[model samples]
Target: MDTSPKIVASVVYGCCPTGEPTVPVHLPGRHGGPNRGELQTVNTYPAVPATAGFFTIPAHADYRASAATVAHTRSLSFLKPLMGGPCFDLEAIWDEHTRYEFADRSVEETMATMVDEPYVNHVPTLTGGIGRAKLTSFCRDHFIFSNPDDTALELVSRTVGIDRVVDWLYDHARQTK
Candidate 1:
């Protein structure tokens, strides 16, 4: 009598429910064969039908869908825990920094968001500083106090990403000679 364990076919689904759909992957293990112990290589397959309460998996002619699904899963693995959690509002942080700059407030608060030893570089004028002391001094002497009382800044756009926010801004101020 045959007592070997019967291997069942397993299906790997994609993470995205709507964007990128994946076919139901069928692994080889039904009958007792050479690939009974090992998983069969999946080259191509038809996508699983989209039913109520189920995701619509897309069919791929080649291995593109499999590769994309893997990439998406890998990218979302770390973000799963952070999703719907207390996320940092970059816009509000930028507003606070701007308020500190325009109101001539304490540079300490502005520098709080930065690392232990932070550096700033004004690429255009090649003027900035390194470390807390130098950066604070530069902000006080060159940026905050030096600007006119009517100075204003216009925010063009802001691009927020995983760990950084890129702001496009235009400063409007009267030059005093």
Candidate 2:
């Protein structure tokens, strides 16, 4: 018989600084074990209101010497020279675009962040179009205006290069008919 503690899924929680609350996290156990693919609710933190699902780390009013701050300062010092020339932060731009998308903003407002002509292709459905006019029409008709109210996006990772950024994300939405 195996006496060792079975390695379970790792769960990461983003917490608020104010209080340590119990948060329930669902974990799907591994297959073919004694706990055979069972859904388990692990109460981790103190209970927080359902509406307060997300938390932000509070910033200090005054600068303090911490390991993280020190590392950040050093990183900035190193990056300052490399980023000195006129450069655009693609991450910020992508974040703004994501916000606009989830908020279901106007197609014109969303397109403002893109080039004069842009193309989008939803490979699975083959639903997107090319050029500003067609893309704008597609967004207005099928995506921006028609997205569900509870639509959300989970950004897994982003790789920003000299001229392009590739983002891996999960789109969460409810189908409405």
Candidate 3:
């Protein structure tokens, strides 16, 4: 199978059953949503089978059913942790083909130095609900090298509260060996 990021996915944070988005207090160190709000323009909309809950802008809205979200999950409340590191900078992996890092160098400097996608800023422009830091960490820890596309699925899980499903998939992947 081919492992490539054919899509772009965003995971939103701070929402409840009815979809009330709040800013996370001292949100984790990662970069997405409000933490870097000044650098982005988010576009949002929702269409539901009621069960598919709600979904937001995805990384690769370029794909079919890419906006698809699992039913009955949709809760931004799950991401109450990770106001720290690791998962915070995970979005940086989105541009697998590019070379950028949040090291001692400024993100602006990195974005400006991008020799690949001249359109790419070291800072990614994202759209979606807020994302959970723990979930964000989990995705980076596991899929960083495999199918970063899994991050897309993870984002879907975060939007709704289907993290258990994500956990199951990861666990099953381990046990199958």
Candidate 4:
């Protein structure tokens, strides 16, 4: 199965004759990714309150990461000198890292997404650590393994800046023990 990431960039028109842009609500794909070039007709979303206009749907389907994002990353791997600094999709990188850490629950895989010397600081608990070895230890013994089996995060909002992507999430978990 293809688990790469897909890009959704299609806009649908609605009943608004005044041409005011309708609110866009992303519809989840059935096969883990939205089908490419397929038009999704949604009168009302399952739980979300649908606005009076059409709902925007995903344009591409079933992707862990888009091919364009992958190619951009690969091309940048060779242009570090010319660019002077890394130039890649921050959102894609963040998504990949989180997927490895939370969903896959692989400390090694999570560490592979970070740098040689990285640091993690949990502001609420004032936990986490610095350096690769310390961070890896934290992930193995404290962070990832400590989560409950039913843990999930609902992203409320995300701000992607040039150098950073800040995500506001709501943690939904029921402690099993």
Candidate 5:
């Protein structure tokens, strides 16, 4: 039951029937091909019995396979969709959050968009709150209500992923005395 990663000395490339490598993977710090220039095909190899019309080319025993290569092979195109990434539109949900925070400036609306018992932590100023009650208080006191007269945000870039959306923005605010 040891789930920790162990060092691998070689990799095996599974090839399709067309002689094309189904997984054209190269493990870093490990060179391609076997230890000997004489490559072993399924017909010539005996250590591993051929199965399901697939064949493999074993790498050199002295070379070590990188951890990234192992992860890459497991997450290949054929398996990624089956792994169950998010199905909803994360960008639109995030846009609604921002709209509630800035445009509407309604603490109730902002909190409505979040899950129950959600938390926020402003890293720079270290000034957000945890839990439903505390976050609502923080939003009303220090965030939504404390904005300057002309405060606005201009998004520079946005990257949406399966679970989250990251946005780079320009905040335009004018101080008022």
Candidate 6:
């Protein structure tokens, strides 16, 4: 029942449920508002994918105006002020995003371990030339493992039986600290 995030941060391109909020249609011609005397038009999202939960972390400002860019760019344009706070579609997510956040900590921890290994070392420098498989692996591992808070990560790890992930990150970070 508790669907809170395992970690929290100013993420970029967050899900936008407001694009289709169920509001009382009491404004103008649709429900007899000031514009009742004139013609009115309503707006809605077009080209919805199979799922809405899917989205990508766009890295550039120009991409905000176009989804095709995200499809071909194959790069992460971090909205530093927002941190990927907009939502596109499932296909867009599949196209642009390499990493995603789940509600489980163990999943994130496991992902981190996988990403931190030699096979995934080229992720830190966010270049766009990497293959989709490699890029996605980085995304999943980077955010899931590289959280800034220890307490929160621990809480998530314990909740999801990631004792190993917790121990690994803790020990790993401690040695560096």
Q: Which candidate is the best by TM-score?
A: 5
- The TM-score obtained by model 6 is 0.19
Across 22-100, the per-residue lDDT of candidate 4 in tens digits comes to 3222233322334333333222223322332322323433222333343333334433433466566889988988888
lDDT of 5 at 173: 76
TM-score of each: 0.48, 0.47, 0.17, 0.50, 0.52, 0.19
Q: Give the candidate order by descending lDDT.
A: 4, 5, 2, 1, 6, 3
Candidate 3 local distance difference test against the native? 0.29
- Candidate 5 on 1-177: residue-level lDDT in tens? 124233211233443223333332222212232432222222123232333112222353422234323334433432335445435676888899998898889999999988888999888899999999999999999999898757888999998755567799899974559
> Please, what is the whole-model Cα lDDT of each candidate in the order they appear?
0.54, 0.54, 0.29, 0.58, 0.58, 0.31
Candidate 1 structure quality by residue, lDDT tens digits, 1-177: 024333222243332122222322223221232322222322222243222112223554323454445434433433433344345766777788778877656577777766789899989999889999999899878867777787887889988754456789888884568
Rank by TM-score (best first): 5, 4, 1, 2, 6, 3
**Span of ten consecutive residues with least summed lDDT in model 6:** 159-168
In every candidate, how many clashes are there?
A: 1, 6, 18, 9, 0, 16
Error of 1 at 160 (Å): 1.2
Q: Over all chains combined, what TM-score does candidate 5 have? A: 0.52
- For model 6, what is the error of residue 58's alpha carbon versus the real structure, in angstroms, after optimal superposition? 17
lDDT of 6 at 118: 27
Colliding residue pairs in candidate 2: 21-45, 21-46, 22-45, 22-46, 22-47, 23-45
Question: lDDT by residue for model 6 over 121-140, one digit each (tens)?
Answer: 43457442254466455555
Worst 10 residues of 4 by lDDT: 16-25
Comparing 3 and 6 on TM-score, the stronger one:
6
How well does candidate 3 match the true structure in TM-score terms?
A: 0.17
Give candidate 5 misplaced runs (Cα > 4 Å). Answer: 1-86, 174-177
